[model samples]
Target: MFEQIDCPEAQRLVEAGAQLVDVRGPDEFARGALPGAQNIPVQVMAQQAGQLEEHKPVVLYCASGARSTQAQMLLQQLGFPEVYNLGSIQKYYTC
Candidate 1:
């Protein structure tokens, strides 16, 4: 199962080199996103999954927790070793 972490832990993970993926749409992403996060909408995550480096861990978040949870499952099914759901971007930004 994928682990769900809070904003503080997410920050630590990113600092430790975990890949931060914002699973929001282009418009949402264009507005703003966590610093260092790459935009990868959940709809296209499967196809773009390969672009992620296998050697590093991956953390996903969206507007709400739902999409990122789905993404976490998809990446896990694709054999990603460490997949974390950081829930909503609001949680991270407000922290």
Candidate 2:
């Protein structure tokens, strides 16, 4: 299973320049997203994985925890060294 990072840790990662990604669909991301999040919906994440910085930590979230979990796993398989699932977008507000 992928690791579910806490809000504070997510915030710390963001503060330290982690790539913040929203793994929901484009429409859902258009509705709203955590501040500073970049939309890279899980559907096309593999194709766009190259857009993410390999040297930076990645933090991903979705409406629920599911999509982000998938994203985290993909990034890991793609050789991203520090990928984290921040779970739901709601968790960002808590941080």
Candidate 3:
């Protein structure tokens, strides 16, 4: 199972050049997203994932923990190194 990183740790990774991915639908992403995050909706992640650099660290988050968790494992299987799940988007606002 993939471990979820705390918001502070996730923030550090983002600052250090990790790819910030929002795995929610366009509508949700449009409403709000973490700073520097790019929407890559979980439904089409496999196809759109090529946009990301395989060598870069990836930090994923969704409305809830579910979608990001799924995306984290999928990205790992697809050969992306250093995938970090930040769980819910709320954590970013609260932590």
RMSD of each: 1.1, 1.0, 0.8
TM-score to true structure, per model? 0.94, 0.95, 0.97
Evaluated against the true structure, the overall lDDT of model 2 is 0.92
For model 1, the stretches where C-alpha displacement exceeds 4 angstroms are none
Error of 2 at 18 (Å): 0.3
Give a tens-digit lDDT track for model 2, residues 1-95: 59799999999999999999999999998998888889999999999998899989999999889999999999999999999998988887785
The whole-model C-alpha lDDT of candidate 3 against the native structure comes to 0.94
Which pairs in model 2 have colliding backbones?
none
lDDT of 1 by residue, 1-95 (tens): 65579988899999999999999999999999999999999999999998899769999999989999999999989989889999999999756
TM-score of model 3 (CA atoms): 0.97
Report every candidate's CA lDDT: 0.91, 0.92, 0.94
Top candidate on TM-score is 3
Taking all chains together, the TM-score of candidate 2 against the true structure is 0.95
Q: Rank the candidates by lDDT, best first.
A: 3, 2, 1
